[model samples]
Target: MRIAGAALNQIPFDWAHNIQTISTAIAQAKAEGVELLCLPELCLTGYNCEDLFLSDWLPESALAHLQQIRPLTEGICVVVGLPVRLHQRTYNTAAVLRDGEILGFAAKQFLASDGVHYEPRFFAPWVAGETTTVEHAGESWPLGDLTFEHLGVRFGFEICEDAWRPDNVRPACRLRGKVDLIVNPSASHFAMSKTDQRYNLVLNASRNFTCTYLYANLLGNEAGRIIYDGEILIARNGHLLKRNQLLSFKEVDLEWADVDFSTPLEMAGELVPLPAPDEYRELNQAMSLGLFDYLRKARSRGFVLSLSGGADSSFCAVGVAEMVRLGVAELGEEEFKRRSGAFDEAKTEVVQTGAGGAAHQTAIDVDNAAETQNQKPDTANQALVNHLLTCAYQGTVNSSDDTFNSAKELADSIGARFFDWTIDEQVSGYVGKIEGALGRPLTWQTDDLALQNIQARVRAPGIWLLANVQNCLLITTSNRSEASVGYCTMDGDTAGSISPIAGVDKDFVKKWLRWAQTELGYEGLRYVNDLQPTAELRPLADNQTDERDLMPYVLLNRIERLAFYDRLAPAAVLAQLIAEDPAADAGQLRAYVRRFYQLWSRNQWKRERYAPSFHLDDYNVDPRSWLRFPILSGGFSEELAAL
Candidate 1:
């Protein structure tokens, strides 16, 4: 039997579009001779439909659309996701249909109602060991304990969270005597390191149950906030028969090899063993999928970066390039070439050949007219000058050359157009104008944050200007680690069309970059990953680092996960942290706790003002959607004081 997995980018609450997408996918699968095809969970109403699920007309409208789709399933078996009302209780359900007949339906057994998902409020669990019949399309369809037989093969179904449960639908099917196949339709959300877990879980479940498993997932941003990373796997016995790329939304086909279920358990087990490696491959897949969808669905051509020669920007740039490469590979050479348009044939110019030393820093003479055309004025160069002076006065060296070189190399390797703009003088003039407007000196001593913010804010206009002129999207370089504690300047480093790594922690960003460079041959862009992170606002001083300014990103990310996401109180969270580190002091603990709450509370306004970011994990901080803190709160001081 040939089974096809159709991963779709379905919009939430748009029944008509959902019907069209499903019908189109079914038609394509039928043309390809696929006997059975499975779509994502909630494909009819979308996964993140939120309160729309409670609308009085939703269930009726969904059933109507299913009836409309029933005729489209000619000569093929199709499974679709929708909310079903049985006995006046709503349940997340999958409806199986073949040849214009409704086969049966399975309700989701495990509802994810915690952390980012509130399914229990709207959906009741499917009670185990119960079988019920319901009327659908003028026929009685089994609504519970469902399994369908087609062409001598018995198949069972599950929804998104059901497969994640320890005693899930797949195992339930295994206990129901001799089922040969289990199909899962999912709408799992994206996170930096989630895909690997999903893959391993499915592989292990298929092997453990001794059945062929077909899994399909949703993709793209559903309902404007949640991103579903798509992956389709076909596993039989104990081995994976075929697997689609981790985050691909396109249709994938896997031909099933008939296997006798009566074979000895050990022999069948050897065919599909569990994934042995302990790495987070699922999270990597989620990141890739999020980036791909962010670019394609956002109608973006490519990305641009400031390339600060720091870990943050370098990691961001490499991630963008990787997404492009993956996209090209998935689309194939012909489609990629067509999408990118004509390639530039210009040769790369060698700049800064590493031969000139400080002694040979003689300014090259050029006509003032040519210099005027090539360079923006000294005022444009002020930010760099101020940065250099601050570094020099502080006896530390902060330069942009290394970062520029790294960015240039990365852009070249990725076949992206690279351009550099030196607006040091222009920026200096702008700073002077701001200072003149205020009638005083804006120095690090007087107002350090305001001073640093000005420098960062100045950089955004130029970068945005270049990105706009080149028709490329500017990639924001802030990471989850920093974003959690509000270390980024609003409309400065945080300003971008899309933030690729915003969902990942800073420590993980380093690890991922190292993995990409050492293990994945992403070597050309490693320089940025290796550099020490700094704002270059103050003259470089001994032991001056970004980590010192904010809490250690690793610790901050952990606290964020436990405190805000897991809903642990501050005292309890501190106790847990102390348990992890016995030597942690009261002062340090209180400081971290205070910082986390203060930054979190103050940054609600900033987050509210941010552009739409990719949602790759359950612990997202999107203010407009996932998190909703009031902008006028009294800050975390009161909370900390009480603690």
Candidate 2:
């Protein structure tokens, strides 16, 4: 038997594109003589259709679309997923179609409720070993936990969360010998070191169940933050047969393998060694892939950032570099930007060249004339970055020479268009206007936050103008550490369309920069990595540092992971840290815990207002994903008092 699994890029409620992509996959699979094909879970309406599943119109529209796809599956058996609404509740369901006939629906037995998922709020798990009749298209059809029989072969399903549960209730355990093929439709989001685990699980399940395993996942950034790699895997008897390239740029990616169901193969005695990409490689691919999709999908031409020469902004800058490098390497320069919807912007011809070009504010000479002569005449990767990235150093009266130089050096090294601007006069103008209105002048001693905020906020309008004029998406530079407290100024430093690093902690970004410099050969990052993290909002004489203003970043990240990520209370965090770190004083731990709770509660509004960020881990503070705290709560005051 020949079967196929497709990893399709699906957008929520994008019915026209969804049907077109799905139809194309079906046609290709049929042409390849594939007898059966399996698609990703909830692919019709998309997996990230969070609350849309509750709408009556969504299911009706999905069912109407399903009927349109049925004719295309006449030559091949297709298993497609969609949300089925019946008797006033929704079920994550898959329907089998062949010969222009609807076979039956298999409902998901388990629902994922933890860490960025709220499936239970919208769907109910199918009852085990129960079958029900559902009315559709003026006919009653079976819908429940059941096996399917077609062409004298038996098959069963394992919806996304169903296979991940570590319990005996797994469908494979029940359908072992009864089914010859086990199909898993998933919309699993990407994370570091997760692919290895998935490969092992699929291989082991196929080996243990003595059946062919076909797995497919959703691809690309569908709605906002979550990225699905669109992984397609086929394995039988402990050996992987065919796996498609993940994180595809195309709309639909399909992989197929020929299977012999008449004879069962023996499990190999030796286990195959599966490997994962290194930390840098994984981050390199994931972030680049995420940025590419984010830019194109949002219809944004390019990127704009206030390059502060700090760890946060530098990381954002490097990501744009990686996007161009990776995107160009995979797809040629023209195709790369074409796919990114940045073709018009990045492909524009320069009217002039050198230091003060029309498009490029500044340019870096790699000084690799000999290498360029030896290599390809035109370096495509560097050119792409130079076009797509428009960076500016927005300096204030309190800004230091080191930060200014750091920002300029990194921008030049990456070949980005650089602009140097000072917001000192703007800050003074705002201060003067505000003081005049109040009839009193403000001092740093009396109004420190106001003084600092004006400096940061004054820089926004000019950078925003630069971004708007260039038709680029502005990138915000705020990390999770600063987000834990209200360290960032709203409508100021936090003024961008997307915050790429907001989901990541300060320590990780710093480490990533150093690695990008020494290991990744991004020499530009060394300048920022060598400098201590500073906002540069205070006087140079103060020697202002981010760590001095708050607790150690290492400790703050730990406290955040424990208290916010792990959902631990203030008292529990204090006790646990005191026990775990012998060097920490009990009083210090208590104070840190108190400070964290207070700051976190107060900053919930800031986090809520932050530009939509990528969801990299379970620790994601984007309210759309992992963490959701009330913007106006009791401030955890009672809990802190107990500590």
Candidate 3:
């Protein structure tokens, strides 16, 4: 028997569109001569429907859509996910239909009720050893653990979280009788290091059950809350039969070996079950998928960045270019600006500065400097400032040669239009304006957060101006590590339409940059990657490293997962940290614990205000969606006092 699996892009709360998408897939499967097709979990209604599940009309509409799809399954067996209401309780269920008849159904047993998911609040657990049959359209269909025989192969069905349990489908299917194949229709949310575990589990389960395994997942943004990675894997007898690497809408067929029910034990010998490892392949795939879908779904033309000669901005530029390259091949230079809104008419004029401020002398000095340096003088600071102002903005009164040159080279390499503008005079004017507004001169010290914020805040208007003029989206350059401990300024470094690398830690950002340089051959990225992390707000003497200001990102991420998401107490988390790093000091641990709670709590307000960020892992801090914390609560002072 030939089986096909489709990874579909599902829209949240859009029943008509979802049915149309499913109809297209069914047509494709039929064209491919597929007898049985497995779609993602909750294909009718979106998986991350949140409170929409509680609405009476949602289930009714979803059921109607499912009925509309029933006719399309005339020649093929289709398993689709939908919420089934039974006596006022909802069950996350999958219905198998063929030839306009319901064969059987399976309910999700293992509900993900913690972290970013609260399935238990909406769905009632399907009690084990219980069976029920429902009459739909005058036909009675059996529910719970049951196998359907078609073409001499006994097939069992399960939902997303159901397969995650130890004895979920295996024992039940074994108890019922011999089954040749098990298909899991899932809507698992994206999380770092999850895909590796998922693939391993599927492979191990196939070996343990001695049956063919078909797994299909939902993809794209669901309700703008969670990103689902679409992966379809077909495995048999401890070996992978076929897999699709692209974690979006796609299809795969696996018909390598026939399932023989009589000799099921023969295939079980090849199964090797090992403990799940912490490989982050799924996280990477999820990140890339989020980027791709956000760009496409938002109908965004492209992205633009300031392209500072620093780690954060440079990393963002590289990530944007990489996303564009991967999604669309050889994205040309013109298309970049056209899509990014970077090529609008100049709104500002650029003024070149000579040794003192004469245009003729400045041009002559530029020539002499170029001749002496054996480089194009016009291509240096002054020329860069001119290009930036003309292409990216309207007016620039002064320009810097060195900074502009570096930015130009970086943008050129990434196939983006590069412009340089010197904001020395404008920045000084803004500083004066801010000082006058406050009627005080600012001091330079640790207590000068307001003063520092002004500097960062001033940069936003012009960049935003450029973004708006060009019809392009600005990419925010804050990394996950810094965001954990509140190291970013609201509307400053945090100002952008999307945060591409917010899900990645500082250490991982460096690693990805290095990989881009050595493997991707983007040498301009190497300069930024090699430099030490700094905000570059003050002079070199005020050199501030992010790690010095906040806890180490790796440790912070682990602590966040364990303490916050896993619900481990402070003392227990400390014990785990000490065991992992024996050199951790009492003072450092106490400070991190205190600061983590403070920043985490205080940043809820900021996180809530942030633009929609990609959901790359299970540990996201999107307050409006994934996580919800009271913004006006008393800070972590009371919690720390208890410790």
**Candidate closest to the true structure, highest TM-score:** 2
* lDDT for each residue of candidate 2 in 1-643, tens digit (9 for 90 to 100): 8989999888888888788889999998988999999999999998888888888879878988888998898878999899989877899999888988888889999999877789999898998799897776797678998788767778999998888876467888898788999999998988766788788888888888788899999988888788888899899978899887777767789899999888868885555866646765676677777888889888887899999999999999999998877777667656775788775522343323222112337542333321254544235466667777888887777888888889889988887878776777778878999899999998989898889888889878878887887678999999988998878999999999988878788998998998899887888877788899998888888899998888899999899998876778888888889889878688877887888788988989898899988876546777778788899999989999998
Segments of candidate 2 deviating more than 4 angstroms: 133-140, 268-273, 345-360, 363-378
Q: Please give the TM-score that candidate 1 achieves against the real structure.
A: 0.75
**Arranged by lDDT, best first:** 2, 1, 3
The stretch of ten residues in a row with the least summed lDDT in candidate 1 is: 387-396
Write down the TM-score for model 2.
0.92
lDDT per residue (tens digit) for residues 117-171 in model 3:
7898888878766789865666677887566777777888767777777765533
lDDT of 2: 0.83
Task: Provide the global lDDT of candidate 1 against the true structure.
Answer: 0.66
Tens-place lDDT per residue, model 1, 368-464, is 2123544543321221111111000010123455555666665454434444544445446777997999998877678778766766776677667
Candidate 3's C-alpha lDDT?
0.65
TM-score of each: 0.75, 0.92, 0.79
Cα RMSD to the true fold for all candidates:
9.0, 3.7, 7.8
Error of 2 at 225 (Å): 1.3
